[model samples]
Target: MTAVAAGSYPTAPGYNVNVRSGPGTQYRVVRTLPRGARVTINCQKPGQAVTGPYGTTNIWDNIGVGEYVSDAYVRTGSDGYVTGRCG
Candidate 1:
């Protein structure tokens, strides 16, 4: 596990991290990710974003996709759409 670069795409080579719409605890479950899930992150925004009728919580944005993970979930790599180590 390493530090995921902010505003950068995830690259764990088989990581399936969660993706929410908002940035916090109140967010609901928007969707689950599988292995090699790559998502772009918006460092400017923090926490989880909730959306839809259920107000699912997960990494999200109008611009692109973001990931919700700790420093231990993934390792940093060159900026761009990197494959995730999903389980």
Candidate 2:
């Protein structure tokens, strides 16, 4: 996995996005990010596809160490590497 630069992602309005232990919904929910919360995307990886306010995608984003949220629920202004890949 390639390392991407750090970037910001805004959660959907009026919804708390799930931060899972893994990249997919099948994984346990680790925490929740409040609506409109701007988070720092640490990395990204392929995982179970999900539909969020933005759209449907299998792209999952790493928000914290061992924590992730679906890209679909996050609004990243631009698409590309946001930070270095997780080890």
Candidate 3:
């Protein structure tokens, strides 16, 4: 996992977000994050655009190996990438 000094971002309140194996929803869901969960974004990559509590975006945050969550569901205080792009 990549280390990001930006800290962690919170998931949309009251919603349990899905963590996919890839950057997009087309990928298999590896797990579901509980509501009010906070995640540290290791890296980000372009993926399927999704509209969530935060807004619409195509950015996906990699929280763990093979685990990604839509940026639209994460409150990162920015509508842009908060960390380095995934290699």
Candidate 4:
């Protein structure tokens, strides 16, 4: 299947989501995205499963080098992976 283009997606409307060092919450919090922040997904990886405003998923979106946010919090339209899988 074709992957969604790398594009900016919004985080859950009113929550400041955590950006982790890896693809899971087990990783350190690298940063925190402010409420209403938008992030351009560079890639994705399967990691810790998370339940958020959208739904439960193990998908983590790479927003930057060493930065990942749960796909559960990003509105990518699809419930599945939107971008290419991170190598």
Q: Against the hidden reference, what TM-scores do the models get?
A: 0.38, 0.82, 0.93, 0.93
TM-score of 1: 0.38
Model 2 spans with C-alpha error above 4 angstroms:
1-5, 78-87
TM-score of 3: 0.93
Question: Considering lDDT, which of the candidate structures 2 and 3 is the better prediction for this target?
Answer: 3
Model 3 residue 58 lDDT? 95
Model 2: per-residue Cα lDDT over 1-87, one tens digit each: 996557776788889888999978899998888767988887789889898777888888888888999888888754444555666
Q: Model 3: residues >4 Å from true position, as ranges?
A: 1-6
lDDT (CA) per prediction: 0.41, 0.80, 0.94, 0.94
| Tens-digit lDDT track of model 3 for 1-87 | 975386688899999999999989899999999999999999999999999999999999999999999999999999999989999
Task: State model 3's lDDT.
Answer: 0.94
Off by over 4 Å in 4: 1-5
Q: Give the per-residue lDDT digits (tens) of candidate 4, residues 1-87.
A: 996577999999999999999998889998899999999999999999999999999999999999999999999999898878999
Q: Model 2 scores what on Cα lDDT?
A: 0.80
Q: Which is the winner by lDDT between candidate 1 and candidate 2? A: 2
Candidate 3 shows a clash count of 0
